[model samples]
Target chain A: MATVAVENYLKHVLLLSEGGEELVSMGDLAGALAVVPGTATAMVKALADEGLLEHQPRLGVRLTTRGRRIALNVLRKHRLVETFLVETLKMDWSKVHAEAEQLEHAVSDEVLDRLDALLGHPRQDPHGDPIPNRAGKIDSQVYATLATCATGRRLRIVRVTEQSEEFLRFAEDSGLRPGAELSVGERNLVSGLVTLTRTDGGKIALGVAAAGKILVEPRG
Target chain B: MATVAVENYLKHVLLLSEGGEELVSMGDLAGALAVVPGTATAMVKALADEGLLEHQPRLGVRLTTRGRRIALNVLRKHRLVETFLVETLKMDWSKVHAEAEQLEHAVSDEVLDRLDALLGHPRQDPHGDPIPNRAGKIDSQVYATLATCATGRRLRIVRVTEQSEEFLRFAEDSGLRPGAELSVGERNLVSGLVTLTRTDGGKIALGVAAAGKILVEPRG
Candidate 1:
């Protein structure tokens, strides 16, 4: 069994690569895990020795089939647990991410399946993140972010890519949660700010960097 | 924040001492934790240094007030998580103990409080084990085990103290779960065996040691 640290490393790698084929940079991996680069290198080498991932000295690491399977399983546990916390326990959605960080490592696959069933097999968590299925398959659909979507066209929020408490609270306060319909009111490329108008006539301004974390799709 | 190993050591010390004022012998602690005596001694010394427990030379160790408080909180998490699993998730009572073992160290106090409220402030878990409160007050009432309860007297199973999977499966299979009302039929001191009769006309026989693990009280 992998230690909790190893699981975190693999899970972060999966997230940082956006579950894509691109090679992750060592700096990005270290930053994502909030560890010094040297520590991250040491662990990456150990994981390589275990055949869970391949470590490219300069480019960084990528999960092998086995590693990706494990990472996906961990991700599945995480999202399902978050869903249970919010939907079943009636916990605050903004707080469930931090709670799920600790719980994902503890829940067994059996318990995860039961929770998934209890939640009626939810496809998305409280944060609108896709939950990997029992077989490790996840919805890989790409969507436009609020920062990049065209101005004046109605879009519904699809997901919030950021997990920070402050960001989530801001998004909630701005009525920018998943399924909320809104249109880009204005964009200032020089100033790197975007203005949004909600269907209810509420307006909110966001920096391009923060706006990029909110994924959206054209309203149907 | 105590590491998982440190938490386990402190929890085991409290359990071995039966939540009493007696010092827990190093041998029993080592055996219970499945570690060598030397490792137990080294850990006890470290924990004593940390002011979590007091260790006496060649005698044993006892939890300091702080250590006892932490242990009780961990126990509370364990029992409440077990209750949530069995009552809310509808998991099998026999399987929840192992699941709760992993979850106890992960759940936050905030989440625990919400779970406690969601379960309607359950006093006893599915196994009939008392759950410590938020303030660390546990129901410490002592009761006679099936091995010691008088023959021909009606008794209700109060708690199944053993958490081993095999023991729990056997208990469940034999209709000896918590709250089951029955009477002791016979006891053989020399043979180390006990016979019991359920109110529903079912008969079961258990070894004296196993019988002692099933606590009971006079039936109302």
Candidate 2:
């Protein structure tokens, strides 16, 4: 069984890979995990020896099939726990992520299954991140972001990929959340800003970087 | 911020002390924690230096006020998580203890408070173990066990202090759980056996050691 540190490392690798074959750089992995580069390198070598991942000298690391399975399971526990905290416990959505970080390592598969059933098997958590299924399968559908989607087209928020509490609070204050209906009124690439108009006739301006974190799909 | 090992050591010390001022023996602590006496001694010294506990050389270790507070909080987390597992998740009572053992170390106070409210501020967990309050207050009432209680007097099982899965399963099979009403029909100290009769007319026999684990109070 993986230790909490091992689980965190594997989960971050999967998140940084973004459902692609791209190798996660050591610096990026260290940064995501809040560890020094040397520590990440040593741990990556150990994981490679354990056959959880493949490490290329001077390049980066990528998850093996086994590694991805463990990572997905951890991610599933995290997102489902976050959902339970928000929906069942009525905890603040912005705070659930931090709570879930600790719980994800401790929850057993049996408890996860029960939590899944109690939450009616939600597909997405409060942060709009996908919850992996019992078999560790995650939804990999692509959606355009507010920064890139066509202006004047009605869109529904599908995900808010950022998890920082401050960012989530700001987004919540602006009524930017999954299933909210809106359209991009204008995109000013020169000024790196995006203007959005909610269906309720409210306007909000976001920097292009922040806008890119909010995924959307055309309203069906 | 105790690590998992530190938390376990302190929690076990508290349990072995049995809500008394008596010092917990190093041998007993070692046995409970599954570590060698030397290891227990070394760790106890470290904890003492940290002001979590006091170790009397060659005698025993005792929790300081700070140590007791931490231990009680961990116990509260454990029992409350167990309650949530059984009540909300509908998990098998026989299995929740082991699950809660892992979760107790990970759940934050905020999450625990929410769970306490969700479970309607339960005072006792599924096994009739008293949960400590947020302020570390615990009910430490004393009760007699079937091995020592007056024979032929109606008694209700108040707690089953044993946590082994096999014992719990056997107790469940025999309906010897907390809140079960029964009377000791006979006790043969010479043979180290106790025979019990349930209020519903079922009979079961247990060895004195096993009987001692099931605490009972006067039936209402």
Candidate 3:
């Protein structure tokens, strides 16, 4: 029964705090939401009052268990919607995120379950992000950022950081979809650019920032 | 950029208007949204100010072309989500409507188109409600209420008017689905009950109210 804005805030806080034992800072939330610090403070206080979040002035923000559940539910809905949009609708990978972002908050548990079944219960979304199970458990897949892949190493794209649309479009055009294989050809230490040869025989250069956003697993 | 509540109003107006010939009353809107007449009036005025609707005093209200477009978009999103939830996630039919209702307002065109493609450009939802096309056009399929069907006529269930979970469960339990075949075995003039024989050789009795909600087509 959470409002859309409230759900969005919970999702952001959960994503920011993933795999970390730290509280998200007010400035961080503000920057993420692109809101003024004062606005973010007001919203955060509202969320805390709703029992979805905990706020400590100097310590930043952490989700209560209830908050985390809601966050995971939203994430599950988003990823499932993305997968449905791409696999069933044949939508361009670049276009599904925004649509899924809107849909993730609205679907019911019954719809979510049916979509999961229809997609054959995919472990990862189109972006290679894990889909949380019914019990809210995320699969712990070990992945390395493209920036850390050694030169000459063969790797398979596993996931990409959900950042800007531009980043997603670049990944799509460069054949960086999940399960695509690439061989690291060279690395520029100064610029953090990495040249890679894709399994489809395509070649591309990725800057450190871009490479860092791409998660990969070493290929045998 | 319409809010969920606003989108709901638009959709309700569009559906209630049914071919844009009649103006929808505030009483009708209130009944649809389960709100008070004053609340409906306030909302209708707000929508009028936004230019999504036209109010004709005692004649009630109607959608402007722009309003129709918005309603279609919301409908497209709703049907697509229902299709996705049922086809992909394996959700029960009864559970998808409420979820899709919320999602219809939030999903973008990109996601909607993708979902349409993923669902193989379905023309109808699970309940046999026609999905609007991309141009905001809905196919007008004629249906006869089961209560009015001639006795001894073979027919097929095409759609149901009630979207409630209890109603859906009852329909399902009675072997009534979109394509289920039935014969009007008997009709009681006094009690207004209809007895139907299912293709699977089962007999079920439907009250006049329930029969009125079911739309059926003659079997070829």
Q: Which regions of candidate 2 are displaced past 4 Å?
A: none
Tens-place lDDT per residue, model 1, B136-197, is 99898999999888899999999999898899999999999999999999999999989999
TM-score of each: 0.98, 0.98, 0.88
lDDT measured at residue B166 in model 3 versus the true structure, 0 to 100:
95
| Regions of candidate 1 where Cα sits further than 4 Å from its true position | none
TM-score of chain B of each: 0.98, 0.98, 0.96
Note each model's CA RMSD in angstroms: 1.0, 1.0, 3.0
- How big is the positional error of residue B6 in model 1, measured in Å on the Cα after superposition? 1.3
lDDT of 2 by residue, B1-220 (tens): 8999999999999999997889999999999999999999999999999999999998899999999999999999999999999889888788998998899999999999999999999999999999999988999898899988999999999999988999999999999989889999999999998999998898999999999999999988
TM-score, cand. 3 vs. native: 0.88
- For candidate 1, the per-residue lDDT at B44 reads 93
- Give the higher-lDDT candidate: 2 or 3: 2
Give the alpha carbon lDDT tens digit for every residue of A131-161 in model 1. Answer: 9999899999999998999999999999999
Lowest lDDT 10-residue stretch of candidate 3 chain B: B110-119
Candidate 1 vs candidate 2: which has greater lDDT? Answer: 2
- Candidate 1 steric clashes: 0
Of candidates 3 and 2, the better by DockQ? 2
